[model samples]
Target: MTYCVGMLLDKGMAFMSDTRTNSGVDNISTFRKMFSWSVPGERFITMMTAGNLATTQALISQLEERTKAPSERKPSILEAPTMFQVANIIGTTLRDTIAARALTGPVAASPAPNFNASVIVGGQIAGMEPRLYLIYPEGNFIEASPETPFFQIGETKYGRPILVRGFESHMSFADITKLLMVSFDSTLKANLSVGLPLDLMLYRNDDFAPFHERRITADDPYFEKISDSWSEALRNAFHSLPDYELDA
Candidate 1:
């Protein structure tokens, strides 16, 4: 399992993802789940994936190959004129990969390997507004709107509340990063399958390139600070709330 989030803000877009995959308690590994491609001053794209590791890996590899050698059947992600088209390419690739895997054998049988996966693709094209999308296993996707400015995948429930309560359109990139970190921290604390060494990408509006990118390890000073601070803040908030009293 893993956790990844992409946010759409007035200033730009921000994405964060964890690098953890586990088949069992004793079978654990770390693998990068974020993929990106950019053409300076032209276009930029980033995708975060979760679900069956093999399925996601194959999906990304297929897309990467197509970009290198695009065909009518397999168009390059960079060639897409619009973010919407880029998303369609990704969604089709994902759904096709899973379908092919299903042909090999039963994906849902007990002790059977799974071939289900999902992705969140976010970026900007030279001529259009920045966009964010959540692509599902079935090749269907939904874009972020004013009412829903962010999308998360993999172990999402543990961290969604923070985003729901904190996201804002006008937030600066810095504030958005902090909010996302807190959300990731919350997910990490509650879920064993999602571990650290996080990938973060920030793109300023109309840049057509990544504005900032970094990796946050468990020992990263800033992330450490955020985790500690959030714990203390949550405790304080809990204590500050009024307790209910029963009439005797």
Candidate 2:
């Protein structure tokens, strides 16, 4: 399992993803679940994956290869004229890969192996509005809108409340980071499979570019501070809330 989120704010987009891949209690491993591509002044795209590690890696590698040989392959997401087309390309690739693997043998047919995968793709194309999408295992997807404004995959339930409570479409980069920390904290507390070392990407709208990107490791000082501060804040909030002292 993993945890990833993409928010479509009035300013632009913010994305965060965890590194942990669930194998088993004893077989857990760390693998980056986020990737991004930029075409300088032309376009910027990012994908945060969850589910089967092998399947996700294969899909990404194929996309990278296509991107590298643009003339020999269909236009990669970064080269697509619109974010919608970019998403279509990714979804097709994911579905085709799954089909191809299943043809190989019974081993591929088994769900125990790494074949279930999905991705969250978010970014911008020059002339169009910025967008966010959650691509599912079947290659179908849904977009984020003003009403939703955000999308999550993998161990999503635990972290959802925090996002709902604090997210604002007009939040600044700093405030968004604080909201993300709370969401990450909730997931970390409830799910063992979603662990540290996150990938973060922030794109300010109309730039046609990704101006900020970061890899957040376990020992990152700012994250450490935020975690500590949030803990204290939560404890105080809990104490201050009126309690149910029924028999009185």
Candidate 3:
């Protein structure tokens, strides 16, 4: 269980993912759910994964290895000509990993554990348009549109509405971060499955380089400030909105 979100803005893209993985009451651990690769000024890609740790880790490992291999199997994420191709590689990797794991387990149990993982992939490849996509377990995906400028995966229900009410295609990168803090707060308050230290990415349009990548912890000053201010603002907004009168 986790919470990961990617937002597509006119200026660029913003992403955040939690690092907590819990197996039971006595077993809680930290494993980064975010992965990024870039060719400096040319292209950049970031992925946030949720579900079974083993499957996600294996997929990421293969992607990383492919990037480093002398004779890479195909168009790896690092070498993809477009962001769409990158998504396809990741989707295929995830699906293949799931399929391989099935060979070792009982027929029915194989899919159960692996099918839970999903990925939110977003960014820009040089000479291509920036985009946000959600990759399902079946090696398929859907992209975010102008009308829908965001995609979220994992323990998603709690933090979703904040973006729904406030997200806009034209919002600046900073405002998008504030909105993400509010959304993560909503999920943090409601779901123990998703916990902090969060990895956040901010990419400016056509820059193809990200200088604002952060791992926000429980003690981080900026996150603390934003969380407090947002809670107070929400309470005030709720009270200030005109109440509907009920007719007799």
Who wins the TM-score comparison? Answer: 1
Clash number for each model: 0, 1, 0
Candidate 1 local lDDT, 1-248, one digit each (tens): 89999988898899999999999878999999999999998898999999999899999888888888755475778998899999999999999999999888775688776789999999998878999999999998999999998999999999999899988989988898899999999999999999999999999988887879999999999999999999999999999999889997
How well does candidate 1 match the true structure in TM-score terms?
0.95
Tens-digit per-residue lDDT, 50-114, candidate 2:
87787899999999999888786577776778888989999998988877776664764545444
Better candidate number, 2 or 3, judged by lDDT:
3
lDDT of 3 by residue, 1-248 (tens): 89999988888899899999988756899999988888877888888999889999999999999999949667778778778888899999999988888777576773355445799998897678898899999999999999777898888898888889989879878888888998999899888889999999998877877769999999999988888888799899999999999996
lDDT of 1 at 161: 93
Give model 3's TM-score versus the native structure. 0.93
Better of 1 and 2 by lDDT: 1
Candidate 1 least-lDDT 10 residues: 67-76
Each candidate structure's TM-score, on Cα atoms with residue i matched to residue i, is 0.95, 0.93, 0.93
lDDT of 1 at 29: 94
Q: Clashing residue pairs in candidate 2, if any?
A: 1-22
